[model samples]
Target: MQPPTLSLIGTTPRMRWAWTAAGVLLIAGWVHRPASAQEPAIFRGADLKLGEELIAQHRCAQCHAEKVGGDGSAIYRPLGVINNAGLLRGMVEQCNATLNFQMFPEEVTAVAAVLNRDHYRFKD
Candidate 1:
């Protein structure tokens, strides 16, 4: 026997619209799911070793120690106002600018990411 015709499959505009909507939803989901997942997590793919090296070169911990006393870790208040990834990165960038560390953008990001991994741990 032959298969049902398009007229028989979707006799009504509502039925056709429903199928269209379902198709749209499916395609939209297929397109969007990967995009959302593809977005790199804060601190993802960071070079920890380079970050450490840069921190040492910049005397970041030393300055912090002088500023707050102790190993300088005390200067990084995990519970203080800088509680987000963007803020954390921004703080590092600001420090980079003010300190004139001349760190590249990626270096700054890597440094901030390492700091986040070690102390901040800001989850999206």
Candidate 2:
């Protein structure tokens, strides 16, 4: 038996043009889609490894545990006031300033990015 194939027989030029246009549009949409759709724009190109290291170095979990009374994981609330990526970064910056961490802007972004990856999962 022969494999089935699409038959263009008797198809009008307008119909063919419509199909071609639809295909082009579909392909263009896919091709033009943002590559970092899975990651927030603020955290793009952030150093996740450095973020992890800084988190550990800063004893963030220990501090959180002291404040919240637990493993410190409760400090991260995905649906809380810090819901979006920008807000999340802002929160990190606030912490850096309040704690006198003296972290650079990129370092703050890196920390926020790691927190987003592990806890918040904010994309955008």
Candidates in order have lDDT scores of 0.82, 0.90
For model 1, the superposed segments whose C-alpha errors exceed 4 Å read 1-40
Give the per-residue lDDT digits (tens) of candidate 2, residues 83-122: 9999999999999999999999999999999999999998
Model 1 superposed RMSD (Cα): 8.3
Candidate 2 all-Cα RMSD? 3.9
Residue 120, model 1: Cα distance from true site in angstroms: 1.3
- Per-model clash counts, in order, read 0, 0
Q: Write candidate 1's Cα lDDT for 41-81 as tens digits.
A: 76677788899889888889998998899888888877899
Worst 10 residues of 2 by lDDT: 1-10
